[model samples]
Target: MYVIYLRKSRKDSDLEALGIDVLKRHEETLLELARARSLPIGAIYREVVSGDSIDARPEMVRLLSEVESGIWEGVLVMEVERLARGDTIDQGRVQRAFFYSNTLIVTPGKTYNPAIENDNEYFEFSLFMSRREYATIKRRMQAGRIRSVKDGYYVGNIAPYGWRRVKADDCKHFTLVPDEKENPVLKLMYDFMGNKKYGFQKTCSALTGMGIVSRSGKPFNPATVKTIISNPVNIGMLRWNYRKSQKAIVNGKIATSRPKADDYILAKGKHPGCISEDLYYRANSVNSSMTAPVKRSCRIQNPFAGIVRCSCCGRVMVRKKMSAKQPRDYLICQYAGCATVAIELDELENAVLEWIRNYIADYKVNNFESADDSEQESLRSILVNLEKEKETTLKQRGSLFDLLEQGIYTKEIFFERSTALEDKIKDFDKKIESVNADIVRLDLSKKNRSTFVPKCQELLNAWDTFDAADKNTALKNVIERIDFTKTEKNARGQRHSSFSIDVFPRISR
Candidate 1:
């Protein structure tokens, strides 16, 4: 049976702009080709994914997996280029899948049988040309977007909260227009910040009090308020590349992210702004002058800053101050959907200290130590030998140059000898690195076993004398994390309530 695959080509931007269904058209053409050839169609894989890598395209990945599993006799497409236009690795993967499975690639103009050498070579050549064409198309698209931005038009997919996009007079592009109901609300937000001297939380309160919400139809958050107040678009300036695209291989997979850029284009836009320049700048200046409450005068307050986790949800619980009527600090879960409950700050600290006290008592009873010095010494010995071998290899590599200069070795011979020695040196370095890591892990184990007890004892003895910041540092050195849970309840007047604290010490619990 034959399967049909359809993916929109980058070359079909003209068709897309003209509101033509390129994928549907390609499918119809392939179905007609199947009928002409008297082929039986088992399945159709229509790919709408707009990405370069096979890893990014789900339908292509599924198709490749099925083809590699030897399920179909042939695959039909408009062209081979539609199967793979990604990087060389993806192209080779697509080629090998069909070649090994003996699957036929049936296109309208030609049919490629991967078993034949001539057909295989022709298939490779076609893929090479397709790759070149794809690269050109990508460059042209980027240039078009840059030109659109420079022409003072709105090119982003979605407009900001207080604006709407309308087709320009030429009907080729879009321009921003102020929204009737939202524009006045945006202006009012600026007025509250600029003239009325309100902070983010107070502004959020003011908006919610007036029954005005965000674009998500929810109460305004401080981060969203900051975005609105800081954007240059409110003052009729179009900004581009505020966050630049960056890609890196993380854990052997390509990861892409957009980070804030220092330099960006802020140009005069074609549409009028909802707020005046005076109000925009004034609000920004006022917002900038105030310090955020979370900074806490550059001092640490939570001793379990990075060491506390909610057992139910695994989220880091934060310490928050209650209202003026209550006037007490409480450790609370961040989200309302979480199953965990809040506890008073003082009570939580007491429970943690008690857990540590019990841990120290248990450690004293065990009183054991790790004797890893001999293994560490053995690893160091191996490292020393590896370094000596690497130095000898480097010296050998250097002598090849002399051999070539003296006409004793031909250029090819010298290159071969030099490459061999370079590879040997690289191997030695890799061994040295592995041995070094082993030695370091041994040392850390010894330190955790021999040194952690005394430190834990000192922390308990001097707990009262240390300040909050010092105590936090001391606690971090001994504790990895504390998993807290409070699924049971007790009387309100009870001091030691029905709660559990599972301490994960760096050494032992």
Candidate 2:
């Protein structure tokens, strides 16, 4: 008995001709073909959506599981991709599922038998072409999104909560605008977090107490609450790739670095904001501490208090006690004959603060280049060229394969040439990936350097006068450690002192 299968992709081209009705037509045609060949038909398996991913369509999944149970003699389909659209990985799954159950896959164009030697190459080539098509589709989709963003349209799945799409004044397009009724929740959240000085959990509880639900109108989980607070769109700006997985597309089936920050289009006042920029920034500063509530409530102590080392291994000395009656703690470095000696924590803190202040002052007066727009543009150009080169190499590889298959070259020559081509392709692919990674890193560095560097300097300059909590936060943000080492030396020997700093803003705090 044969099982007729069908699938439609997300593309309008696929949907227009091969939607539900078209699948029904294919079913009718399969029945006619079956009758003409005197083949017994048992059941039909149909998927209304694309099979770019195996898990995307439930019907296809059910069919594959049933096929593996040896419930069908064959899977008849209109085309190979209809059974498994877009990629070899997906097609391989369907091929294996049917083959393991001793079933054949019969397409209108080609009937593939897994056991045949010559047929293996054909199936492999077909699957490879499917994957290539998938990649092409992904490139096109990304390019479209880039263009759409440039055109200033919100190109996401759904508008943020408390916002609704409405026709722009031009009437040619739609824009997101604040929903009058729903926006109140945003204001409330901002007030609780900012003015009320409530912790995240407290704010969540307060919302629930007030009978207020999340954007989804359900109990708010910590993740959801965090996401709401962190989303820049609510504060009249938009940031992409905040959730890394959102950058992936099913057609590619691989994680890729999202578009750079420079690519994000900003439309100011395009929609009424739920919270002001100052309030949002203030809220972020208030929530900067990553400590849990339990730690905040308890008397927190660090076991590795002074064990951490700095660039110089001078033993971190501490003052034993203030006096005969009072207890005191002070960090110092005691390296004999070394210029470094036991200095009061207060004194050392003052020195570090002076050094940081001088550093910032020098940095400012030197007219240091923060980030130039032209640099971002240049990086984008480099990435675009690399992508173009990758595409060209893929097409050339395809042509070489065609030539090999057409007997334009002998097997020995074809094998040697193809091997070299594959090596070149792999090298180019690696280079492309490397370039993309560099671009992502550069973008992130530029963003952080611009937004946080000034803040860093400001905190450092005020470190000496900062409150205990602020001092701790500043120290945690900047210094990795202050090490101390001791050494025996001749009496009254002169000493040299040296220290180094490695600033890693991203990973430090």
Candidate 3:
């Protein structure tokens, strides 16, 4: 009995040559060939796979197993190349298997009867041809992909939802443009991401509630949604040299690593986008800022996410839930080897409140009547110097022009001297405008400072009524990074809370 076999390569050109149901057709051809040779065909086995690697082919293994069972005395294929490319190693394995099973391998052009010595060389030649064909097909497909990319065609499948792929004028190349109707989603997504209050899940829920389906009208997936939010292509750029692949080097050469942000190929937008450049930038800033938070299994909001840091280990201290059964949570140091014990959330809250109260009182004590006296003086000095320079430069320019008009100097000489003085005057005018703006700011600052103190005192008085989250926000608004360091006792000493705080008034968290 004879078994029919069929195999097709997944290469691009083969995709065109073999048609869609190439494997099925090849199996049919094998059956017909078996019938023509008056062979009794038992089973038809078909294989559809990429021919890039031959380490694991399930159909190939099944064929060998069937031969070993002695149910089929021979196998018939449409062509010899269908077995495999003429690779010596692969052919050797196939030859050995057939020899052990005493099975005959027949193709349209030639037959491999292990019983005949001369048929062995012909079988080997068939394997070599298949391998050569595979290499040729692969090379051509790769070259086409390179040419397409160079011509700015978007080659990947489906093209990430919000984008629509359209072929170029030539009909051979493709490009991506933002889908007009779906582009509004980008702006809405950015708005949600820019604020820390709305997280990934919340954003998705909000969008779903707004009757905003995905580009395909399906429920929004968190993974796919997150990818769309973070993709650089939204900012009118394509990524090249993005994915890392394993490759061998002949010499002592190092693998070049491309920087993700810098590796994107910037392209002009071919379609209208809903989000502006500024908003896109802000969204990216928000996305990149909190990478560590999203990876955590537990979702406890960290009060001092980017602010608090351990002095010894230099890791951010995160809030940890101590007991799920009780309302007992604590702030724990994030450092892996840190010996610091977790401070109870309630205790830490009280400490922060007390510290803030003390901080406000201390700030009030240092707040003299002329709180910004030095800044005011510096502003006045700068304004006066600028006014004097402007006056001098204008007077010099006026005198030079007068000399030029009076015919006291040649046109060339006059232009040379006048150009030099006019340049200086322009420079001075810019400095004057800058100084005038500073003077106005100083005036505004002086006026605001008087009202600011009372407003700050009012907020502090009401701080006791504020929630933990609100209090954290208020404190961060006033202070930048607080250095929590161990306070050591000196010769005449007093011990502090083991940690000292460094506060900045205007800097951000």
Report every candidate's CA lDDT.
Answer: 0.82, 0.61, 0.64
- Per-residue alpha-carbon lDDT of model 2 for 345-408, expressed as tens digits? 4544555566556656765775334433566667678778877877887787778778878999
What does the lDDT read for residue 164 in candidate 3?
80
TM-score of each candidate structure, all chains considered together: 0.63, 0.48, 0.47
lDDT tens digits by residue: candidate 3, 1-509: 88888776554355665466776666777767777889987777777664433345677778877777777899887766666663466667677777778888887776788877778777766677777777787679767865666555666667755678887667776778777776678668878876454555556667777878776665564545567776656766555445534434437432443333535344444334445666666655653211245233643355555566666666666666444553666565533234454454555555555665675576578764355677667877887887888788778777876887798888898788879988887887888788678767766766655555555566578777876566666666655665444424223333222444455444211
Report the candidate with higher TM-score, 1 versus 3.
1
Every candidate's CA RMSD: 16.9, 22.7, 31.3
Lowest summed lDDT across 10 adjacent residues in model 1 is found at: 287-296
Best-fitting candidate, scored by TM-score? 1
Kindly report which residue pairs in candidate 3 clash with one another.
Answer: 85-127, 85-130, 85-131, 86-127, 86-128, 86-131
| Candidates in descending TM-score order | 1, 2, 3
Position 274, candidate 1: lDDT: 77
Q: lDDT, candidate 1, residue 287?
A: 42
Error of model 1, residue 342, in angstroms: 8.5
lDDT of 3 at 232: 58
